[model samples]
Target: MDIVEFLSERISEDEAVARTLLGDRTVSKSGAWYEQRLLLECEAKRRLIRIVESARQAALAAMVSTPDQDVGWIPQSLQWMEQSLNALALPYYDHPDFDQDWFRT
Candidate 1:
């Protein structure tokens, strides 16, 4: 189903099991919850990336093959392209240890 529901269901299940055994430390499942959240987030993001990529490809095809290139839809199409690029670029935008030279040819 939805990402939030999937994440919450998994996390709640984990927490319930943890509570039955761990007896509540100071962290009290915070670490486990965070880890689970991160895992779920990654999974959700993967699905989202696939969906966005499909839409981006469709938009690109439309932008390339359309006859009326001088219409207002061009700007909207450009905006979609930029947004899709930015969304896909987010994962690589920051890396504390990755030097710029590593990315250069």
Candidate 2:
């Protein structure tokens, strides 16, 4: 699968794992409930972090870079933006089938 599809699947799988972990969980005022809820919450949050990171990277990979004419040796804002984007660990950038590299190429 392509990076987008691969990441999308990962996100779906992660969401499923999160849902499973959080299934039927309820909270009360008891200390035991609080402690157990904390553990489950941590696990769910970790999975959520991964999903969010993947989505953010995909968005970054899809960003179009438009460099303006440079004056002297100083870089322009768009150039900086392009450089920052290129420096990111975007998995979508590695796939040959991904067509978002038209501007980067």
Top candidate on TM-score is 1
lDDT of 1 by residue, 10-79 (tens): 4455456555444446554776576556556655655765665576677777777885775456557656
Give the alpha carbon lDDT tens digit for every residue of 17-78 in model 2: 54555554563346445555655654654565455556555444445332343333333433
TM accuracy, model 1: 0.47
**Where's the lowest-lDDT run of ten residues in candidate 1?**
96-105
Clashing pairs in 2: none
lDDT of 1 at 89: 37
lDDT (Cα atoms) of all candidates against the true structure: 0.52, 0.46
True-structure lDDT of candidate 2: 0.46
TM-score of each: 0.47, 0.32
Candidate 1 segments whose C-alpha is farther than 4 A from its true place: 1-28, 69-71, 77-81, 84-93, 96-105
